[model samples]
Target: MLDQKFATLPKLILQIVQMLQNQSPSDSLNEIIRLVARKFVGLGVLEVADELEIQEAILRLEKEIIDLEATINSASDIKLAYAHNSKLEASGKIVFTGQGAYMCQVSAGGDVLAEKKDSIFRGGRLIVTGNAVLNELGSPMATPTMVEFVFGRRILVNRVYPGVSFRVGRQLFKVQEGLQDVRVAVDEQGILRVDYLYKEHLQ
Candidate 1:
């Protein structure tokens, strides 16, 4: 039964078992003493104590599997976050246009030394192209230029409820999730409309 349980254990646990199995015979014997105490609970009569100990070991192994699963999930989330930040493929350039804006161009390059009015570029995001120099603030309602971050990086604003925000505009947007739907919009209200609709889709 122990052998079967060991075989079904998670890969990490299996590696641990193999490590123990390869230990010196003296080491294995000493460790087995503890295993017996914890895993042999089910044996009846004269061996009842040994059986109960084995049962306890089996319980521990099960718990280890559960713990391993949780760890894997956490690793997955971290990996996803990293993918969103670095190693992300930049698709195309999004140009920002506003009143008195012209000949402004933004590219997929993380770093582009471009100038525009009311626009600020940072962290190698969307390229802004049009008339006039890019200013940090184009319109309060819309991002003059921005990138769609695949993974939303959270910032703690309020310690109580874990208030978080992402970077946006000239500054960080401080969104709970990453940015979404980054496009250049024409007209005043149109930019705001684009941001609102795109943000919803991102969620």
Candidate 2:
């Protein structure tokens, strides 16, 4: 029954071919010829639609790959550093409290030596140095063992004293002394900076 329905396809194609030979080149004629060719080759319109969808999907995948590569390259260009055998020293005014606690903020002064990006400095130690005074009223003993330097929420140095250096990571420092008012001030334009001197490993 289906064969009988399509038995006139050949006759129909012949009519279209004859019509095209007599007609001038036009969009409608071209469309009719394309449809007839597809039908004769047993290629349905649904198959052509599926092929177009597949091509579009491939294009989208290629675009996504390009975007991903760009993101990875951007991430690689970002600068990051870890604590190594480096020393950060700073001198600033220390505000001493009556309870023997001291607070100070030291700016990097744009001369932050640790800002240098060297491959050898990765995963190295970090030592911090600065002027510290022990409050004699708080500890009753002027010893390095009575002083403590707190970095942010962590205890950086439990035992320290004036002119003694300690190790610290990337964090702010708050000194705890006996009851001494140790003040180190800088010029109005001068920034209380930390000088980071890398270890000899980088040499």
Candidate 3:
């Protein structure tokens, strides 16, 4: 017996292929994102306690089509630092309390960070001068979230939505599938890599 969840994926792919043949990549991306958002339900992109949360996230994702390579700048509501490493002392830290953060952008610098649960950074972008550690980004739903750094080279996150884009210097990484607890960084070779780091340093 075929599983009900995967039933529409093949059809979706066929539609995408046809769209590609008839339209430019940019022209078809919006539709493709929409189809993916609708089809990805129960596909296990996130591990949440309630089904409602998943639906809410998906609904939010459907609002914005992800742009993988476009330069992103989120309208910010919070500013933690100015990227000079002077505002925060070595012992300083940044914290996001209950409900994490939603619908607004956060800009920070350096390595001091921690967040509570229910974090879904949708509809905004994050600008950090250094490393950015986030509990969640984007959503299983498919909205694209951007994290930009002019001087930093790393971003660590526990949960990733499919369209989360990271820009570190000239390197760019766009997550096309859901991921958990990974590191995104530019290596010594100046190449960007997404992988797991068993131990992390927090300041």
Q: TM-scores across all candidates?
A: 0.28, 0.20, 0.47
lDDT of candidates 1 onward, in order: 0.32, 0.31, 0.56
Best by TM-score: 3
What tens-digit string does per-residue lDDT give for candidate 2 at 1-203? 33443454455545445544534534644554465456434645345444444344334434433544454334111122332233323332222223222222222211112222121111112222333332221122322222223232111122222322233333232233321223322324432322222211211
Which has the higher lDDT value, candidate number 2 or candidate number 3? Answer: 3
Q: Quickly count the clashes in candidate 2.
A: 8
Worst 10 residues of 1 by lDDT: 154-163
Candidate 3 versus the native: TM-score? 0.47
Instruction: Candidate 3: give its CA RMSD in angstroms.
Output: 22.0
Give the range where candidate 3 is weakest over 10 consecutive residues by summed lDDT.
81-90
Off by over 4 Å in 2: 1-49, 75-203
Off by over 4 Å in 3: 1-94, 150-152, 196-203
Better of 1 and 3 by lDDT: 3
Candidate ranking (TM-score, best to worst): 3, 1, 2
The better candidate by TM-score, 2 or 3, is 3
lDDT of model 2 at position 95: 23
Model 1, span 36-146: residue lDDT tens:
444442442235345445455556655544544554343111101111123232232233333212222223322222223423332333332222122332222333333
For residues 96-146, what per-residue lDDT tens digits would candidate 3 score against the true structure? 544554545556644424455554465457766667677777766667677
